[model samples]
Target: MKQDIILKRIEEKLKVLKKARPFPPYLVKKLREQFSLEMNYNSNAIEGNTLTLRETMLVLQQGITIKGKSLKDHLEAKNQAKAIEYLYDIVDSKKDIPISEMLIRNMHSLVVQNIDGVEAGSYRAHDVRITGSKHTPCGAFEVPQKMHELISWHKKNKDNLDIITLATEFKHRFVHIHPFGDGNGRVSRLVLNILLMKQGYPIVVILKNEREKYYRALQKADNGNMEDLVFFIAQAVERSLDLYIRAIESSTKENSLVSLSKIAPQTKYSAEYLGLLVRTGKVAGVKDGRNWKTSLDAIEQYEMNLIRKKK
Candidate 1:
């Protein structure tokens, strides 16, 4: 099939997906902020310098530094959030442009940041491989040709799929190709959220507890069965929606549930500065915990503390 035709088919399928999943106002607000936070977190994690889930949370809440003991530990612990944050930035841009070279570079840059022996912000010209689950394939799988084909194929047929499913398939294919020497899982998940956030969905964080089930779903997809993959992605979307809904509901009672876009203007600082603060462990309130459960008051206090320290 022609690449354009295949892409169009995928896009049409995405339209159906949109119809299948719709978001209300509160959910939209919650998703906007949460996904942004998550993308930043994931991007940092992938580069071999990350905090634990708890430490990341504290970074968001109290702005306390919870450094990793070493490079491997940091990457293993924080890569997921770092990669997702990378995705959020791409998909959440206000430029109204299609995903382009700039975005890919940005994602790659984040994926390789602070990692040892990895060229941060560059694609691997070297060979890559995907190690399957124990129950799945045992042999080490090479991915150079596969990744090149996928990218070329995506460009050829991008129009066929809406930005959302394009992101989803990209995520799937990224992991399938395992293009990087390490951190493929983190990058792939981040790429997925980039697409989802672009489509106006919240960032979906699969908890450590559910990691096995998540792997199993992907394993099924690897075996030429997409039912589980489709189901799992759909469920992730649904959970993202549910997370935002809960956040809105919980915040509404306290009259603190303001939309992120709206808050962006009223604050004394730019989002970029806040993001840096977030990275350095000096601010709080983000979209995580399958919902925006992080406390806004805590965020406020953390920011205030930063202000005092800066003086």
Candidate 2:
């Protein structure tokens, strides 16, 4: 799909999400905790952290050490949970925390605190090369200066660019700079969500299963082709929005309980196709014995996502 069209659909969904906000405090907390576990697990997993989602949750929630995982693996989960909490604290502060060098450094520090304190919050002191990529990071001496430039560019263009584009650009450039010796990927993802949260959007979790595509998008951004990265981020945002919409709709409406056959007539898709989607887990739903039961909103979101993908 074209970047502009993808972004327009994301913006439309974001508007719907904004109107659905001020979800009950309890629901909000529950969602945050759930996302924290998923984000921490996926983000760390992308960086070679070996903790499974259940293992990460066990470490974070129950403080139970998995028998075979490395200390660094456990620490990565704990540190990322802390970093996510820090992000939320900033979001809930009602204080304007502009994207700055300090904020970036602090987040990086939280990410690497237990693993590498010496360089946790500081920029690298030597040139670094990213593995499996042709792009070279700026020299250590240039990291500070380039970071300042990045912050300035964000401040200047934030109002001019749409949120998805702005967040994608920031992630692309930040990773391109490769300021820190470690935790760059994790920190970049956190910062991306921070930018989205600042704009009243839900956090986008880039799954570990998407590692290759995620890396490819970043590499494309490095090559001055940002369309791929933008589209990738848009899809993630759309997924989160769909989750929010489904959750909210399910809570408020009694009409959420419906069979695939019933929603088929309301959508352009055939019942067989809708049933196929349910069986394949493309649509969010529960099974009532042999039949697939799902919410109307889920069908709507599924159709909208399909339309966006085709465009």
Candidate 3:
């Protein structure tokens, strides 16, 4: 699919979600804790941290270290949680914090503060090569200049590009520079999300299961083709949008609603078809456990709109 079309669909869902923003404080708290655990686990896991999701939760929440797990692994989980908290602080701040070299460095420092204090917030002094890849990062001496250029580019083009494009391009360029000797991947992901959250979009989580595919997308971006990466990132954003939308819908009190299966007999569409519509935000509905529940009136309204479009 074309990037513009996918982005347009994402924007449509975002509109619905934005209207429901400042989600109930309890829901907001729940989402924050949930995404923090998932994000920390996945981000660190992709970097070869040995902690599983459950183990990460244990380390972060209970301070219960796993037997035989490396201290670095525990620290990675803890530091990432701190980094996530910092990201949210920036997002919630009264003052707007534009993306900058300092912001990037601060985030990197948070990621590796305990593991490598000397180089935590500092750029590398030696050239580095990415393992298992053909891309060579800028020389150590050129790191500062390249990072300056990246920030300038963001300021110049942020308004012209859509949020997904802007964030994905920034991630690609940042990783391409590989400014830091270590923790570049973690910092890149944090910066990508900072750009997104600043624009009011939900944070995108790159799952550990997608490790190979995510690397391939970055490689493709290095080759000057960023469509795959943009789509990959967009899908994650879409999932976040779906979660928020479903939560908002379920919270509202309404009568005369029924499951898609029950409404199927009253409309021309099958339950499967209506379920697809609900999932894609084409119809108004709430997901009730395993089933999509919606009002018959919503289905009728959607049918009427389709008829009008056809005419």
Candidate 4:
């Protein structure tokens, strides 16, 4: 039931975003800049990069290296940003772009260019295991064949499946393939957003703060369960949608995310309870630092559902 509501909201937001095209140049520039920073920071952070979101902005936009951060961390930020730009460049220049293995390798090459120079774009040459998971990655010899099968699977189902399911499944499958020696998670996310962008959906960021939950969801998918993983991706997609719409419309009251305490006053629930709902996936909200933020619009939807359930 919660998943349905979340997916429905995603469609609604996506529809709004689609109708707003051809998006203005300024809007595109604004959003692309913000999402670039977001993708660079959060994706690297998930893989244990230590740069805070602000520090990421400094490194990418201002080229100011932090005193204590490792050069590798800075390189990860810059490399990931370039990977994001590469995707945007292709999406802008091409029409009906099919995601091919070549494109995947190209993105991987950008992701690990200097970090892992020798094997930047090549598939791993040895067996790899997912940390803290029961599923073992395919042997090095199988990476090529498995990746070929993955591309084939995507081609076969790309159009038939809904957008979230298609992108999310492709992401998990890519990470499951674990083709690269390192940077699989980061590359998987980059490719995932490219697929989303190809279909006109916004860049979906799996949050750094939710890193543990994200992994657990993947582990479950490895065990043949995908519901949790789908919703996790869905929430991120919707959040981006919220941001784009709020920016485009310049109307934050209903679309913008506010602290839970502010949102709680508008509904019958208390802030702590709403936080619980956010954590348990009963409502749509985002983790901002130590606090959780939700929109009044989401709480209203929850209340409306409650009324319907009673009737």
Per-residue lDDT tens digits of candidate 3, residues 193-247? 9999887887778899998889898899999999999999998888887887786
TM-score of each: 0.58, 0.80, 0.80, 0.78
Best by lDDT: 3
| Deviating ranges (above 4 Å) for candidate 4 | 251-311
User: What CA root-mean-square deviation does each model show from the true structure?
Assistant: 10.2, 11.6, 11.8, 14.0
**Top-down lDDT ranking:** 3, 2, 4, 1
Q: What would the per-residue lDDT of candidate 1 be over residues 25-82, giving only the tens digit for each residue?
A: 3334446556645544544443334455456655554755555455455444344345
Q: In terms of TM-score, how similar is model 2 to the real structure?
A: 0.80
Worst 10 residues of 3 by lDDT: 21-30
By TM-score: ranked, best first? 3, 2, 4, 1
Q: Identify the superior model by lDDT, candidate 3 or candidate 4.
A: 3
Model 4 local distance difference test score: 0.84
- Report lDDT per candidate: 0.55, 0.85, 0.86, 0.84
- Stretches > 4 Å off in candidate 1: 1-51, 59-68, 71-86, 100-102, 125-145, 156-166, 249-311
Q: Going through the candidates in order, what is the number of backbone clashes in each?
A: 23, 0, 0, 0
The residue-level lDDT of candidate 1 at 260 comes to 43
